[model samples]
Target chain A: MNHLLNIVRKELKELMTIGSFVSVLIMMFVFMGAGSMMGDQGESITSPSDIGFINGDGGLWADRTEEFLISIYVDTYGISEEEARGFVKVMDIPLDDGAAIVEGMRSLGLDAAIAVGPGYSSNLDNGIRAVISEYYIFTNPGLLGSAGSSITSLMIGEISDRISQALVSEIADPDLTPFLLSPIKGTDAHTYIDGELHSGVRPLDISMGVMNQTLMVPVVIMMVIMMIGSIVISSMGNEKENKTLETLLTMPVGRTVIVTGKILSAAIMGLVYGIMYMVGMMFYSKGMTDIGGLGGSSPADLGLALGPVDWLIVGTMVFLAIFCALGLCMILGAFAKNYKAAQTMTVPISVLAIIPMLLNMFASWGSLPTAIQIPLFIIPFTHPMMVMQNLMFGNTAVVLAGMAYLALFAMLTIFITVKVYKSDILLTGIGQTKLAKAFAGKRIR
Target chain B: MDALTVEDVHKVYGDREAVKGIDFSVRTGEIFGLIGPNGAGKTSTLRMMSTLLRITSGRITVCGHDVATESDEVRKIISYLPEDAGAYKDLTGRAYLKFMAGFFADGAEAEKMVAYGMEMADLGDRIDSKVDTYSKGMMRRLLIARAIMPAPKVAIMDEVTSGLDVINAFEIRKIIRKISEQGVTVIISSHNMFEVDMLCDRVAMINDGRTVLCGTPGELKERFNASNLEEVFVKAVKG
Candidate 1:
């Protein structure tokens, strides 16, 4: 036990000494902090006069519309003081008598423009519909969409206010006395459901949900790859480098004990960094939303369907996936002549592990081929994300099966690593094995 | 009783035969020297005896346990310092000693053994410092310290003095002599004929992995009509 513990401490100390470990953590923090700050900018409201309108109508309706728009913008979008300054430049465009500097403002990516046509008041008096061209522009097409929707919402509110005022004026008598005088209930009260109620949940929110889920897939893929690849390869390489492997082999301890000790240490580190990276990713996802690159739903909405057992299964699969990676690396390490060579050889294996995760991410579970699925199920990592996805959609049986398969896979990897280590530890140099030689060894000439 | 026995041991690496059926025994309380040229399989022969490598087709017994079948039992009875002995670089010398000590803790005699080993190593203040900070001589001593700290029944040192200065080399020889006198078998391998002549009770000269000459330093010098063991080696290899 002491020997194994000593080995673990030695491994950790070496990892901590490397510059790359610290650098990755530092970068995650800085990027996440910047992202969160930008995400909180809220929405901006601009009026036509803010864009510098000047026309024969003398800005009367433009001024009224600006005032109304400002009120609605304040009540709805919740733009911050700093955000308002950046957005205030768009309000400088003029909109009076159906004329606005639309071309110049559009080129600058200004948010709002109001063009009141020559017969704007005349058309209202004659009760004829006319187009009052109000255009909002933004550098980001998505932000432009949000600005357009906010403008439409402002228009609805203004139209509703006008209708309420007109109906009040039509009945000059106080409205409260009529209800008692008629003694009959107002012709039948009707309840209407507005389409805006369904549409009002911004497309940004839905798209954000898609963006967050997709983002998790790749980051998790890279992390799972590195966790399995780097940890296992480096550790096994270190053993070969120190030549303690020869010492370990001759000890009374079984070859499996040595392999298990290494795998157990690697798994613990993998899980530790795995949890750290998951937390880092959570911040990263939050940061994306904060920076406005993603503006959809929260992460919870996607993961909310997965129950505790499903999460446990996913966690276990991740652990096993790490174990399998460690096992694969140990086999590679045994064949490698030295540390640098082992690291070089393990790269393709890591890429192989990552590719499956990526395919699992983009393709539906059932759509994957049987050959792929059989191998995929046997990989500890392949199942977790897929199972997590299935769990979110309420598939319990898949999660259970995934957990079982991953456990079996972990055991198999352990067995293979031990066999490889026992056979090839004393062998020197990196030698390529033919497809037939992969599961067995032949004497080199 | 002999502390170590090698009976017709052979080690073959592919088509190349390293140790070709060499046989010898080192009784308790004697320092045995093995001397040979490069590629003469001296290290391979030592490795097989130490249980670090397998005997290709012969038997090796350490303290009455078969090296092939009871390797761990054989290992506990012997301390082996390989040709390229390495110390864990990250550990302070003292920490390394304690760590090596911890492996034998259940024996009830570990603390006394470790203390005796430390004193025998004669590292002075440097043992508390990290091994990376140690000089080559200091590192060698620490390795020797760890190997001996367990107080095994026999000790195998292979070219361990390759990098040491003359004075430190003599100091190491003196330590080996003291341990040998105390009933522990010591097998020392070196290419330096004079060092072997000065230190060993009985010397074995290997040529092409076969024992060409085996006798005490005095007996070999008398038989070869040579002034020193170096001439004895040259004469034996030439023949």
Candidate 2:
């Protein structure tokens, strides 16, 4: 036990002192903290909001739409009449001058740019509707951006209907009114997900949710597992190759002591990495979208009101995953002849880690067919990858079940790792079988 | 009193026999040598005596402690230096010695042992430099110092000068003689006949894992009617 403690101390010192470890650690906290702080902004469309108007059609309808945008901004932020004119800037963007519009908005630091499509005038007359392209400087983001774009489109449509109504009313013939266009409406309505009927929930909301769940969890899982695997393998393999392990074994210490010490060291390092990863990702989440929390809006506007329970879910799942990864690293390290061969093992292990993450991104257990969902749940890595999604969807039962399985899996993996150290192949640097020549080989050390 | 005992120690690897029924004993304070060619299993025999390799069907003891059942106790009294053993690369030479010394003693005793190890290294101020910065000879000297510093009842050194320049090898040989003179029993294995001739009080010629002949270097040379220990080794292995 004394030997084990010494080994752990030695391992941690090397890991922490390495230049790359310290630098990367600092980068993660800095970037992530900035992102999180920025993301938690309020969502109310307030005054001093930068709005861009790119007029493509150069027609009466385009001019009218631009006027409506300025009025809405004035009303939304409750600006006074004197300052309302300064709240919006309308630039004449020619049909072929789309590139200039992008550059023009970038310079103005605009939040949302209104790009009037070329077909606006013709489509309004012929089809009673036209498409207006919306570009947010941060690009089209979550709830706030979608809400802005939809509001502009609706205002334009209302103006066009009024114009159509007035044109027919001015006609001398009574039959002219009968020939006027009436807006087409669908009779049937359907929704994919049930429960709380929230308003203004756009398809882009689903897209934002998918992006949030996929990017960090899958990629980081692969990175952390492979990194810990490499460190453990290199440490053990180098000891064997250099013949330091032989010297250590002959010391008056039990083999289990040494092996346990190594596992503890790597596990702690993996946990530290896992924590930094989550923090950085939370901050990165802000930079991706001028969403509810970051954009000075209520986080609930984006359905992203994550509480302490959610954090606990992420923490527990990540901890279990690291524990399991550390065990696998120890076992593979012992099995290897030296560092190089052990490095080769990392490739397959990485692929295994990534498979579940990929699967979770496309197939949430709630949506997947029952046949496929059952098997995916059985795969241990699926739990870590799916924990966030499950919590988001309020599938508390699945998260609890996954936690139970992962705990058992981690225990079993560590048990096997400990058993491997019972007999070691020390000096020869050749692992004949079962970590050493346990049977059909040398009974000697 | 004997410092080490090996009774019919056999080591089997898979379908092959690595060490077969080797018996030997070393008196306290004696510098003993196992001299033979490659694949002679001298290393295997020494390994079993050091409690490094488990015996197949025989008994071994170090300082009256059974190497098999009481391997930890056996380890307390002896230090085994494997061929081409290496220290932690990033640690300073002095730090490496202290790390090893920490396993056996503590407080002033450990500090005293560390001081002795550094003194024996003869590395001057370079002992404070990382082992990675040390040359091959310097590393060997540092490792040798770690092994004998604790002043164990018996020190098992395998090829203490296997790959060294002449001056470095001579210096290490001188250290071994000094260790013997201090009444520390030393078990050394080497193919270098001259080293055995110069340093060993008694020598054993092993071949195919068994000791074929054993005596003092001069006695073996005279008995085989040979000019030196090398000729005696050659004759015994061939027989």
Quote each prediction's TM-score.
0.65, 0.68
Instruction: List ranges where model 1 is wrong by over 4 Å.
Output: A1-232, A235-239, A242-256, A291-304, A371-380, A394-402, A420-424, A427-445, B106-109
Give candidate 2's error at residue B8 in angstroms: 2.1
- Residue-level lDDT for A181 in candidate 1: 28
lDDT of 2 by residue, A1-445 (tens): 5999999877776444333343455556544643442343223332246566778787766776666666665666687645656756776666355456556666777645555667666655554445555544323233333344444445445544555564455544554443344321211111112233233333234435544644577667767887887888778788877878778877777766777777778879887887788688867866665556323322344454557978787778878887777777777676666776566546545655755665554345564546656766766667878777666656889999999988998888788876666443444433444434453223212
Q: Give the candidate number with the greatest DockQ.
A: 2
Tell me the alpha-carbon RMSD of every candidate. 15.6, 15.9
DockQ-derived CAPRI band for the predicted complex in model 1: incorrect
Which consecutive 10 residues in model 2 chain A have the weakest lDDT in total?
A183-192
Tens digits of lDDT, candidate 1, A150-267: 4543453453354335434544456433322222111111110111112123333433454465446445745866756765676556656765455445434456767788778777
**Candidate 2, RMSD to the unseen true structure:** 15.9
Q: For this target, which candidate reaches the highest TM-score against the unseen true structure? A: 2
State the displacement of the C-alpha of residue A378, model 2, in Å, after optimal TM-score superposition.
Answer: 6.1
Residue range with the least summed lDDT across 10 consecutive positions in model 1 chain A: A188-197
What is candidate 1's local distance difference test score? 0.61
